[model samples]
Target: MLERNEALKVIHERHSTRMFLETPVADEDVRAILDAANQAPSAHNQQSWRFIVLKGKYKEELADLVLSKAADFPKPSSTLLRLASRSIHSAPVIIAVANTGELIARGGDLFNIKDGSGVDFFRIMEIQSSAAAVQNLLLAATSLGLGTVWLGVLVLIKDDILKFIGEPKGEFMAVIPLGYPGQSSRGPKKKSLEAVIKYFVDE
Candidate 1:
């Protein structure tokens, strides 16, 4: 195998997976994924990210909660809602990610101010840190030939999910489902760089 440029291959191959096989992911693989997540860099090294892995009965409970919320919406609700409900039960592992939140005092010290704006900045940093960790987690899973999907829809039932996971008041970020692929495909093509990116250069 060509060792050089393999990271780019992994990045290009990783896609948001939907359907998954019933086969179980090995415990070692799960641990490796988490280890990759833990290695992500954080603002001020606070490492505010936290995770809750749901499998077996816990996965069932997640589907129940999401479905309960979906029922309140219009009939034949969003496909995303349907997918979110199905992912928990269908995937071998579902990992819930959140932020512990920056300590009020730390935030004040970081920004050198004791004000609400400082708190806001701290909150954003917390999310950024968690997001980086989650990206690492996804890439690692992809390298291991595991399919994964980042389910941000979990934020819809944030309160209920937090309570279920026993982390009341935690900033729910996302739920990631991982397993062997049963059915999945790369979604719509991404926009060209010229269409979305703006370059500012010194002239």
Candidate 2:
């Protein structure tokens, strides 16, 4: 278990890193992050997350595709694009998280649920499970002294991304670009916890 101060430091220092250095994330580090992700709790112990690591030429292609799609949409300021461009060029790796939508049976019993019902339940579980895994991955990266950013801008162009990654239909959830942060990425301002959280209790 991590000490409280260590945990707090990771949480506080973790920010979306856009600009990155050209250093590649080591295979062992990637495995460690994935292992941490696997440790995330899932409903009924259904762990249904798939990840594709893109590096080298593949990463460059993904960045190009993303920028092409961005050009077609309403966008943030040109400054943002310039920053994203630099980030893509500098980062050495990108990871695409995907979902298989496979139903995980409780125990060895697979015939307990109705046919379609199992799939429906699994779909919902996959989304929740994968999200938790992603959080774990990000936190793990921070713990390893690496930086990561969750890019939602390109998520809207899901179909294009899926095609670019050669993912068959119904296999992916989202793509996350991972790497070392360059000196330029200023983390975005976050809302205060008081403004975003609410508590109610009865004694």
* Top of the candidates by lDDT: 1
Span of ten consecutive residues with least summed lDDT in model 1: 71-80
Residue-level lDDT of model 1, residues 75-179, one tens digit each, is: 445556777888877899998898887543488877678656677778888889999999999999999999988988767678888888878877888889899
Question: In every candidate, how many clashes are there?
Answer: 0, 1
Q: Candidate 2 lDDT (Cα, whole model)?
A: 0.72
Model 1: how far residue 109 lies from native, Å: 2.7
lDDT for each of the candidates?
Answer: 0.85, 0.72
Listed in order, each prediction's TM-score against the native is 0.91, 0.80
The residue pairs that clash in candidate 2, if any, are 19-182
lDDT of 2 by residue, 1-203 (tens): 24479878787778888777778889999889889988988766767677788888888887777666666655473334445545666778777777655544442245466555566566677788888988888888989988887665555667777777776664566666677777754477888889999989787
Stretches of candidate 1 exceeding 4 Å from the true structure: 1-4, 75-79, 103-105
The residue-level lDDT of candidate 1 at 63 comes to 84
lDDT for model 1: 0.85
lDDT of 1 at 57: 91
